[model samples]
Target: MDFLHSSWLIGLAIFVVVFVLAQSMFFLVKAIQRAKVLKFQTSDIKRVMVSTMIFSIAPSVAILLGLLALSKVLGVIIPWIRLSVLGAVTYELPATINVVEGVFGQSIGQRITDPVLFVTVVWVMTLGVLPPMIIIPLFLKRIQGRVKNIRKKDQRWGEIFMNAMFLGMISAFLGYVIAPRTDAVTGESYVSLLAIFTLLTSAGLMAIIGVIITKFNKEWLKNYAVSFSMLGAMALAILYAMLGVR
Candidate 1:
């Protein structure tokens, strides 16, 4: 863990955080200035700022949970930096688990104390996300143009195409959630019921929240729905674990 939490790493993490904060502040200031130039009401701007701040809290709670999960093995600094930056929990946890189990053949249940293993995990996680950065800049406009053309030609198929893409991405995670694995010690295969149940629970909660938002006009829940679903599913996971579900 010493390597994971070395002074140099801590300093680098702190530097990254401070740089992100400064970048955010710069953009915020610029936005406010532009808003003023555009003759937006001061009160309206303030209200928007307050509402955004409130809405951010729920998502931050989910990120905090991810940080805790990763911190247990990777230590606090790396996870903190990752989550605080562009990294999403959806991508970070799975990438870490994949590298630990698939690449290194090690259990995430144990801390990554080896500096080489730690570096490898960090590099894999970092590199895995790079394709998106490159792809978006190079091809996103072309993709959007094609989507627009499809929508112009046939709106229904356009929507179906978009939904198909989304579901295809989701299926990748679903595969991970429901996949079976052999216990390293026992050599017996078993699926992770806890993950499957948690996924179902979260999906159920999201569906309920969607119903409330649509049928009952609880629009504000839209901001908090994902957070609530994630937290509820996590709570159910703990209960499942206590009941000996693996």
Candidate 2:
């Protein structure tokens, strides 16, 4: 039996995907019903749903790109299940690489052949990300309650705290993009100029979109502004690469 294309694995993936879709539909219906009960206009609910769906496209495409890379190494079923569940490519790629190189002394460029090695990689990937799953289930309610208490005590401070957290995360990624690197042979300082360019381009495009939406009152553009900016930035990155920016 070919583990990579096993019938059972494909069936499992299909089942999981179907379950996820069903869960999403269930929640969406419930939310719409509750919104109606709260006297929300039907048009407002539809607009919210449409905007949310548009906002999700770019990120979902990014995930699909990750799935394509993972599929080359681990085959389709495993990556399909992982990405459909809690596994983002950020975590999944590193976990797979770490186990493949550290434990098996193999490269991910090659297909995983041995069942034992494959199983070990799967176990490592699963265990590495399992802590968050456990923690969320056990502590999420308490954490939410504490956050609510803080907000109740000082609403302004609570908003500031959340903004700070978001800024910290963004700063970390920005730092990574601009961090210095040395050429392997030339000993010259290098940085990911393409990444910086892409980041700035995306930011500029988003800012422009915000200005246009505010100044001209282009309300419909708000639904797709982020997606447009992201794709535009990605295209600029490719152009930057072609022009030897990095």
As for candidate 2, its clashing pairs are none
The residue-by-residue lDDT of candidate 2 on 1-246, one tens digit each, is 789879998998999999999999999999999999999999888878887787788789889999999988898789889899878999998988988887788988977878888888788888887887789999999999999998999999999989998999999988998998888789999887888899999999999999999999998788778878988998989999999998
C-alpha-based local distance difference test score of model 2: 0.89
Off by over 4 Å in 1: 136-246
Clashing residue pairs in all predictions, respectively, total 0, 0
Kindly report which residue pairs in candidate 1 clash with one another. Answer: none
Instruction: Count clashing residue pairs in model 2.
Output: 0
Best by TM-score: 2
- What lDDT score belongs to each candidate, Candidate 1 first? 0.88, 0.89
Query: What value does the lDDT take at residue 63 in candidate 2?
Result: 95
**Model 2 off-target regions past 4 Å?**
181-189
Error of 2 at 163 (Å): 2.1
Model 1 C-alpha lDDT per residue in residues 1-246, reported as the tens digit of each score:
388889999999999999999999999999999999999988777867776776577578878999999998899999998887779988889989988888889999878988888888888889888888889999999989998999999999989998999999999999988899889899999998888999999999999999999999987677667767887888889999999988
